[model samples]
Target: MSAKVINITMNGLPMEVYEGMNVLEAARIMGIDIPTLCYDEGLSSYGACRLCIVEIGPQDRTKVVSSCTYRCEEGLEIRTHSKRVMDTRKMILELLVCSTPGSKTIQDLAAAHGVITARFKPEHEDCMLCGLCVRMCKEQMMATAIDFAGRGPDRRITTPFDEASALCRHCGGCMFICPACSSRCMGPDADTTLCSSCLNLSPSCVEVYDHQQCWMPPGCGTCIRPEGDYLPATGRISEVKTEA
Candidate 1:
């Protein structure tokens, strides 16, 4: 085979792809549809969803593979969609939807795959651990404020020390990028006095710092502020006021 040519059979059709190309890209060029959720165009591939599963090799000896992360090799025979592949994809989607019942992304994917209902109860109401938030936080934003705090089913996005993310820049990037957390809400300004019901603070009127302080860089220390502390320079006090 030529250095620039990569021979592969996609869906039983002989295909030639560029060397060092991923299987998903090649299949896409051939107009083969591979359902994917965690595969972004610019970010590194993190095969978390397992929706793009395919069988590669001869019909009798083919093996299941993830098309997103798998590279195309010379003389590789690939089945873009097969009974086993579809069954695996369906099960993966089922589990994901069950884990995140309220997620629009999961619901849409399930509908596309013809999954009417999930077999297992939702492990969680949201957050499928797809890593889009984490990746965007690290790669695009260049901030390691938020991260996967735990392992397996207990995994959750959190800041260091499980407190408010002090290193977070309050950019709201993770909240925006996350498919599970795609919600937009408008509230009073940060300086406005909020009701007790709306304010979930402790007894000391402490403000939970969810991101890195404007004065701090690459550290969470500067973000720490005592409860009832007034803003410096502005002389805004946090005194308890009583209406006459």
Candidate 2:
């Protein structure tokens, strides 16, 4: 079978790729690196981070756009890291880091771009609002247990009515896939919780916990408790009967 071809240019370098492939994937295949925090190979393009912005066009060149969401088209020209693009990306990373200072993903991205510190004060405690948790829950787990609750800055991840998620299988997939949760503790106690840092720094803890079953308590019942009986016994009668 003949493969479909799509001609494009990267930094003035002419290239040909498949018709349906995304610009970011095509560029990666061609050894072009576009820094991205929200774009994951396993998940769909979120385009929330806006770090992988690239200039694309031919005659009338368009403004810098996210390469992760943009598809490669015939005769398309892309500039992965122009001066303007780099500056914009840096600002974006700075803003994201300012919002979520504790996020390792944001810190790593900032460091990669030579950003020593965030310009603005930290606003949020956790969660960058990248929508990764919501997307993963819906798409991968096929459980619409939680989602974005509000709009703009007030937006947060939550189940319906901010209660325990019934649709959730407790698979912990959302927590596992979350970059924010990656660095937190997992046990009943916050201090004893297992985080990504704990896992990496103390690999032996995983084995010890597994052998001791520290994470899972013993004598745990999977079944639900039966409701209490309200009806009285057939042989039992009231000693002092009052007027009904």
Candidate 3:
């Protein structure tokens, strides 16, 4: 039987999506992109990365929810790139950068979300606890070779007793799926906690509205605000034209 359809609003536009479809799925169907790291199509939904968060419900009672794990409901209102949602995502990216300073995936995502710096001390650690490796090994590879152990800051993915697991076929699926496996081309030294080398342009839509008006990247170079001046009310992102 076909799934039931539900009505929902996203980014001020009404969408009819499957009732049990997650926010990410609904967004994907509408050609809307919501950035995510730990939500691979081959794997199950694991909201560990916190990158696909979106603001839901009315302004007075809005709540930030992970799109990968949150299903759409009737009459639900979701804003994928609101000021509050972007702020929360940027904060999460900063923390991820601190945890794994060498991950190219994390670094690129940070730059995309306008995360220029990380406040916490850089751990330069190998893992950000996304659990992709663990899940890949158990579910896809059919070998529970490694599992997360410990708690708090000490938590980690390791074989039982930290010994080499005999069941491991070393098919390299875990390493292949690991987002942190791709290290920054430059070294992750203390001096370079964040590799902003690839950073092109930060979004300026946040300065104008609570949510982004122009969703495109390097969008509307027109809104560059002076240090002591606000943009003229007449100068809007839509007024500026760019080459396609």
Candidate 4:
């Protein structure tokens, strides 16, 4: 038998959706926009980025939950843009902005919420730890070269044991999937504003870019290299050799 449809109230608007449909999907179907950075339709819901959080339950006692992974239920009452939901999202965006002040993506997201500056001292980190690249590497691309390391304040994304792994296929999936760090690359043909300081000095390159290629000789015209060689964003010497 086919699954039964479920009725729910989102932002005071009644709607019907499939029994197992997630709250995010239901909201989208009803034209409710829920901001999300970590929830990609092509990949599993990791819930690492809490930007898509929504307020649930009756007004008396509502709680916040990640709407992307939360399944809809009969008579469920959800508020996608309630004051509480917007406050929580603003707080989350503030934290992300403090860590990644230089990230254009994060900055733009923060600007949308009217957050000019983070109250917390900026940690100067670029990666928002959204885990999209890591999940994409493990589930979609199947490279499994990088993962979360450390705990608490020191926690960060890195290749296994904080070193480049031999398993990386240089598919550039990690860079392509990263929302914050991937903004550096404009595509293969278009030049990017990438600099050697970002490429060699920062951990953002190792975490977001394919780790194997970050340590290799840099020749991409996007940055100033020692040899002045112009290469593609993939940082593949093979491409330079083949073209020559």
Which stretch of 10 consecutive residues in model 3 shows the poorest summed lDDT?
A: 203-212
Give Cα-based local distance difference scores for all models: 0.64, 0.64, 0.71, 0.71
**Candidate 4 C-alpha lDDT tens digits along 119-221:** 7766666677889978889998888988999898888888887666787887777766777545532223322221122332233364334323432334433
lDDT of 1 by residue, 102-151 (tens): 44566667778888777886554446778887888888889887778787
TM-score of 1: 0.72
Model 4 regions more than 4 Å off: 184-203, 206-244
Q: What is the TM-score of each candidate against the true structure?
A: 0.72, 0.72, 0.75, 0.78
Error of 1 at 66 (Å): 1.2
Model 2 clash pairs are 185-193, 186-193, 186-194, 187-193
Which of the predicted structures, 3 or 4, would earn the higher TM-score when compared with the native? 4
Ten residues in sequence with the least summed lDDT for candidate 1: 193-202
Q: What is residue 225's positional error in candidate 1, in angstroms? A: 29
**Candidate 4 local distance difference test against the native:** 0.71
Residue range 103-126, candidate 3, lDDT tens digits: 677877887777877798777565
